[model samples]
Target chain A: MQYAERILDAIDMETFILARDEGEAKGFMGRFLADLGFTDHDIVFLEQVGPGVRVRARAYIHRPGGSYGWLAEGDDNGG
Target chain B: MVAEKKKILLVPLDPVHDMGLKLIRKALDDKGHSTVLLPPGMEPYEVVERILDEVEIDFVLVSRTLGYRVGELLARFVDLVEVSGLRDRVTLVVGGMAVRPELAAEMGFDAGFGPGTTPGEVVAFIEDRPFAYGGRAEASEGGKRDLTHGFSYVYRKKEIQKRLAAIAGDIMGWAANKTSPGVERARLRFQALNKGEKYREEFLEEYLDYCDELVVLSYKRKQLPDQTRFLAQDELHFLKQYQNWEGRSKAARSGIRKPDVFIQYGTGCPLMDIMHIKVCEAWGADGLVHFDPSGGARTEGLLEGYLAHGEDGTLLTWENLRLIKNFLAPNTLWQVRAHRGLNTPETVVLAGELGADLTKINMAYASLGAGMDPARITIDGVEAIRWAAHYDLPFDVVTNEELSGVPAHKAFAGMLIIAHLALQLGGRPILQPLFCRSPEVMIYGQMRDNYIDYNAAKILALQQIIDAPLWPGAPIGFLTHTEDRVQSSLTTALHASLARSLGVEAISIASSDEAYAGGPIAAASRVDTLRATHEAFRFFGRAGIQPTPRAREWSKELIAGISKVLKDVANSGSFVQSLYRGLLGGPEDGAYPGRVGRDTLLRKEKGKDV
Candidate 1:
């Protein structure tokens, strides 16, 4: 997964994510991560292998509220 | 052998400013020092305990902004560090405003950093690298000892000396760059303050009278076009809902006193924005004042875009205007923001000439951005007024300043005086002083210094101005919502309750849709509910009234302070200049990064070459 998707997943889903192009995504992702409210989430990196694609996701997850779940849907056509 | 990146602890003492901590963090981080930020307000003992228990920290940088308390806190913190036996292990560096470097060293701090320490000097101290410590290479040898032994005291002493040198360098840099836009603004502020005997005699009396007039005038302006998309975002849905309600007309609305304040949800969110309007209307608002600095960019666009959300969204164009006109009273003028670069004075003049009831041109920061000399703002204001007049366009001039980091007294004085000038020049003035508070106040619900005072003083001053007709503009209420804070509804209810006691003639409540999403139909329904509650209360009687002696005292003191500040700044030359000086190193003037210019002010330290 691109870095931007990982950072956006850290915050409440209500917050909208805007991306102008593919290239601006990573830098914007870092900034977006820095702006989230103080959440005591440990950084977790998850890697999922699909039919042909490998994706890495950097996530901040806490189980205090049982808001635990994985956003791992393997893609059939992986690049 | 590679040396480990040393851990550093940064502690920002209470009663001190936060900028220095942020600046030092950036500088040290760049110089390969792994720094940990201790939250503000931790006691010195707790801090010492944490340092002892945690990783081995090489240096402790403590910041104290307030003057006398710095010595006391530094002494206590140093004592704790010594008692903890880590005194030998950790270097101590004290930095902040009003810190006497020599005195700090005497108090047992190995080094002292006063204001203006550069990042490069800090880097040299941290790395134990051979570089110019102060400004000269000669002082470098005298300032250093072997970093291996007595590492705590030796490291700290060298860091302090380097920091003092950095301060001098920073001041010299500022002196050289005094003519830059940021510094010129400061110099101009000081100049406006020292407006000599001659200028004062010529202008002070007229200025005071103008101020007095602003105090008495009742400002009125055009409401947003009735049928604008912001208002029509949920009009069809609202109409449908109202039609279904028993005995209500298809046109009978629930929340908005008029369609103008009830309808549009600018791009940010609808709850606060729209809720603000409903509250204002509930208070029998005289007119609506819309502040879309970016001209309702995304929020309004969402409604106009009609991306399968509301199928019958076409009325958002001109038809919404017609609907709003049908719903509201004739006193409304939909004041549109017009600046030179983004908006043409002529287009707005055409708007007024084409029968726009009011056009608002804001000339505080935008005036500066457009390269308008401070003196030229008056010229811009005059030109806008002249065009409006020539075209028989009735319009208002507004200063939409957020006034972050400014003291309340300065903001109120400036807004009142500027509004008075607009009124004198034949244009109605709209003053949105809340536009100038700290983001914390706006976003986090923390009270900016003098927020209540400014609010009260503004209301009283505007009341006097409207009554006297000395200036053309009157005080119009802004429908501010604070949903992010706790008990926001209760807060709004309390605000309305207090506003009633303050005797404001008009007020605004945003529709429910404000500050959440665009003014969708669901949001409008929420506002309608609030409007009904307000109307129901009005229909019955005053919401129970009782004021404690303390509450009354606070109210009086706040208003009085606001009055004094206004009087003082007006006595000086430009209100704009005074306001700028109030936020000399703050973010509003674009001096630094992050909120209130804390981060920008801190990068004065330099990183050493690795």
Candidate 2:
């Protein structure tokens, strides 16, 4: 969980999901990322190839102009 | 200096994989180091015996692809050498797949090299000299290049030149006495910036008078636009701290270097843009283009803040640009684009004052495709281009109108007129022809056969028209991309390779998320294209991609079509009228002359708004 704080902006996960259609594949991926507790997420890429789908999805660990986990106030101590 | 000749040994531990060692031995032999390469499948004790029996072996180099039990196997060899009493005199080194120097040291070896280690690197290790890895020499010395350097701007097609000259003269005469809100804002901003503190407030008061009420409210009432917020203090503090790291990345330039690659970054937020810019620079982006919000273009003025919008492009603001400018790598070319915006003049002023390396300007494209008033943009664009020259900032005359369904020839005609006008104003202009599967191409089947010939034809035609630099995109492979990262990256890389093959000065490439309209572009998508382009350059290495004879035919056709469009515009007698009439691009072609800022021109002589 602490490692998540070091991410620069967002974390992307590229994977494959076996599903009937592109929509179903995307649905499965959304649930998969949600299960892992990523809310601000979107499927960057999804394609129904063969019986499965090739998917690349992302969850924003930190958005720009928001409080950054990477720049978490550290030993420098809340300047 | 030739390294001191020493006896070296090379041992390929694998039974049948000695090709790497053979190459290393040849390099070592050429370097005057006597290398005794032991055969593969040699037992550790046999190699130890050979080292012990050999006359004072100075080095025992072993090559083994780390596999199952390979680490333990190499450790036993080091132990055998130690027990034979030659370990003190002999240097033992291991190299092959998956071998890191740390792993080798842990395995009781002196050093190790992973895959992609060159034979020259191995020789340098044997010679005890430093080896520059990953072509760091080129990256460190890879200085910034002027995209418009060494172009004479001579027109090879004199007939087209005549038509262009007429168009340029027509535009200049029309723009001479005219001004717009954009122009006045730029002038006031320029005075406000250049003048002392005494006159700054006076100029800003006059500047706000020309801006939209929303803009004036932002400056005076400190009210921000919808979905726009200023960056928090701690975020900026972290950003300021982020500015400390040096640009130690240039892996993007792994090989051939004709066309410098640029990446456009506008993550709606300046902080995110900064992160993307740094990631792109590390990945070897030679330049960065600041993509501002489309809403900023329709609005009559630019805001002043570290504004962050939850949108597609970053908001154009002085504070946002200044922050981005400050953190740019020393050699990284920075471009602040105002090509299609209502704040064209002020954007140029900001880009110039902030030390941006480049800017983008194109009146015809702005008026027709991007929905800006023809007359207003001409006046504003003329002023912007003039200031771009004054700031010594070279700009690209982009033909993105082609993507709006305007055919390449018509869009190119518009581009040439604006480019010539800019050149006459003393600003350097690089012609940016969209290397895309445009609506025109899709409808006309100009690229149905291949993505080659037509794209190559654009370059070829431009080269024929003028001896100026061609930078082939705002992002090459625009519509050819799928959401698939592999497909998107390959198309971009292929287009880049094509641009490289044609010897262009620069190109803008898209992140693989170019087709993913679902959300904002991801950082990983940017990396995919960059890494792909790197491999593409390394793959071709001074070789060229040959387009079929159809390229020449298309080149001739494009040249003729551009000529016909220019002649038509010239005969129309008024360039602005031509845009209104859609001589450059019309309703049929999906390019509608915009009405924003219409009837808003100010005549200096008449002292009234038109």
Candidate 3:
């Protein structure tokens, strides 16, 4: 019934961050995930391109080997 | 029961986007339905008036692709249909890239088809029948494909074949009367699983002697290894709920029958693995290969229970395998690797009893690449091959030892010997050559010009030696991927494209996180490679990827090299001694005989290992 429970696993957020380097991009992403109320998160990828950093951030709504509420009674199976 | 066709009206409600509607109209016409098409840019009022002018239009199909104010425009059109009092008479359907089923239903449309909507799906909707999405989403209809269905498994070149046969004979002769604790455990496991619950304790009493302390702790106290845990009662119930849930999945391939894309899943937890399997299956993965923890391989035995781990490899357990197996889409080919482990034969027994479609066993890779003693693994691997035959499980003899700097010819020599030994033991063996950017390539610059020719040469060379099914990988494109998801996925997709061109039957593909060693693979990373592979297959369906003339030269070199290695292995007094002396691969070649399970081979007495 909860929105987070709708996701079968984790959700990945990919975007471009205006940062000087990979470390700065990672710092911004950590804050971004924190500001978005995510705790179980990781910066899966970060690369410093010409002007900005291309990054893929992930929030683990459900870690593996744990209970998946998404598997519970539901109409929409989220990816 | 076939539904009777009726008159239909197709309206492309957007400018210059009538392609979907035109496709639907053609499909409807093919199904003997009457249809009138209004070109793109038709006003909603004009469409409504046209429907009204028609003497009994059973259906009105509208397509809208332009997204700006689309919801409001659709809502206004639905209100117009309602005001006309014709909503009850006509089944109003909406479809296009901008449409969602819920959004259309909320807008008062009868149904909606979104992007990637096929023509047959629209027909299924109009005919009021359930669309099974080629029976892939729900049931099997020609879906349980055999990867080795047509391969003849005959040697093409007689000289190489003669050498391979002699080498394999020497290896089998050496392995014939040899046994190990691993083999003993496999026999005990076979007895335990078959003989009823009453005999379990008795079986474990004998089986535990062979198991390491960590494994014993897991069974006796229900204790878990580091970073691993057993699923709680509530979590198990949730998995049970998943067992009854029916979901949809499209095939990853765009219609090419060979080269089924297989993904590896083992997030150290059966629950996590099930989730990954669900994701991979839904994304069109045709098969799943179970990856056990490397530590578990070095350990003497496997554990049981619905275990979850915080690491990369899933712990090999009968309970874990059965739990994951229960959730696999019936059509997805399941491969439980019995390769590179102390429990090789035992894993085969578990994989077989649990209805696995395939198993992987390569004694050479086990000894040289995975750090298992050549002598111990050879004894157990031979037993594992026999069990593979008994269980009707065709296994891939992977030449991943090349990753440790072994050349393709030497690795292929080992692979061919094992494959030949499997044939002699009545087991079907698939040749798994790596389409990798391996150590050999980095050292020799064989792949400097392109990743295609050397890979093509490997396949071409193997084809000359034997007619067995070729499946190019245990995660193709190894050592070529980087931590960058795009690069990782692209390399995987490109290698898969090459595999399709070379006519391979299956390939073990890595997730987009293949190069990332810092964490367990993310679900999104898996999707990246699967989607890329799907696109690649779609992009290059039967077009063929051409390798340069260098491929023929490399193929000839590889064949000659394999023949020389096979001759040396056959001439060696003892096959086990040859492995120790590095006849298959040597120290300079970045390969050394394994130390794990070294000097552990036990002699069999009266058909039982002592």
Which candidate number would show the highest DockQ if scored against the true structure?
Answer: 1
Question: How does chain B score by TM in each prediction?
Answer: 0.39, 0.91, 0.97
Candidate 2 regions exceeding 4 Å error are A1-79, B1-10, B21-36, B46-62, B75-94, B100-112, B118-136, B139-142, B196-199, B240-250, B253-255
Which candidate comes out best when scored by TM-score? 3
The residue ranges of model 3 lying beyond 4 angstroms of the native Cα positions read A1-79, B134-139, B606-610
Fnat for each model: 0.00, 0.00, 0.00
Name the weakest run of 10 consecutive residues (lDDT summed) in model 3 chain B: B132-141
DockQ of 1: 0.04
Instruction: Please give the DockQ score of every candidate, comma-separated.
Output: 0.04, 0.03, 0.03
- Model 1: residues >4 Å from true position, as ranges? A1-79, B1-333, B337-341, B344-351, B354-362, B365-378, B387-403, B430-458, B461-490, B513-522, B525-529, B532-536, B543-610
The TM-score obtained by chain A of candidate 2 when compared with the true chain A: 0.86
**Docking category for candidate 2?**
incorrect
Find the 10 residues in a row with the least total lDDT in model 2 chain B.
Answer: B245-254
lDDT of 1 by residue, B1-610 (tens): 3335788888887644667788878987876779988888888998898798778789888877645456777788899889888899998888776454455676688777654455655666677663332211221233321111211212122322333233223323332211211222222222333575466444333322221222112111222223332334564455433222111011112222221221222323222333333323322333444333232211111111221122212222122323333333233334433442222333344344334455555444333223233323333344555455554544433333333333433334344444444444445444443422343345534344433443454444444333321112112123344433223333333444444445432233343333344433343233332434344334424444444344344445544555555444444444335434442123443322111111111121331111
Better of 1 and 3 by lDDT: 3
Per residue, candidate 3 scores C-alpha lDDT tens digits across A1-79 of: 3888878789999865546556678789999999999999987765432234557899998899988887773635543
TM-score of chain A of 3: 0.86
